[model samples]
Target: MCTWFYAEKATLSPIITKAQQLPLTDTIMNTMARSAAMSGNIRPTDMAAVFAPNKQGNIAVFPMIWGFTVDASPKPLINCRIETADRKPVWKDSWFRRRCVIPASWYYEWGIPPSEVGYHNA
Candidate 1:
């Protein structure tokens, strides 16, 4: 489950302006600027900010941080099982306090095959 998500530009402008006044580096500032510039116009996937309110009631917008994934760990966490998530250590904190929602027109799910499969075969 996503404990936080980015809001639409109309809802995020004021928050973005406030974030600009903070003591952030040039890169951070630039990214925020870019995100604000693209807000409401681009696909959500292209936005750079994490549009969620923090503990202080302020929006927790931040620059995109990069990470890597390994082929060995192929399965990705696209969704969390809401039923048992609260009991899990990794997601308990976010579930309790920082819960967030991502608005979408539709969502996609894939069906599993009964036999072995590979990228090429699929």
Candidate 2:
């Protein structure tokens, strides 16, 4: 049920570049800053840091779209329950092979109780 999160370029690049053992370049830094998504209500085309193996064995941080594309629909599925993923066909392969970690400073939640309405820590 996660629909929002906070991300900062400062954290994302290092997490990826370090994992892949890459030096930070000015171009990538600029791209990270420009594309930084620091909000929870992200859409399908939004980018996030995901890990993938490069030619070498080390994992590299890669920019990936938020969710899978759905045929004949504009909106995509952003969240799924992990408990049932193994039994679901759509996520079975990804659950086993394409597992990843998302670098988030925090997350946002709505409709919480009066004292916790605006935001919550991740």
Instruction: State which candidate has the highest TM-score.
Output: 2
Candidate 1 per-residue lDDT over residues 30-76, each given as its tens digit: 76444334233233223334455766888665533211123555432
Global lDDT scores for all candidate models: 0.43, 0.56
> In candidate 2, which residue pairs clash?
4-40, 5-40
Task: Compare the candidates by lDDT and give the number of the best one.
Answer: 2
What's the true lDDT of residue 90 in model 2? 73
Scanning candidate 1 in windows of ten residues, the lowest lDDT window is 112-121
TM-score of structure candidate 1? 0.37
lDDT at 63 for candidate 1? 36
Taking the candidates one at a time, how many backbone clashes does each contain? 0, 2
Estimate TM-scores for all models: 0.37, 0.58
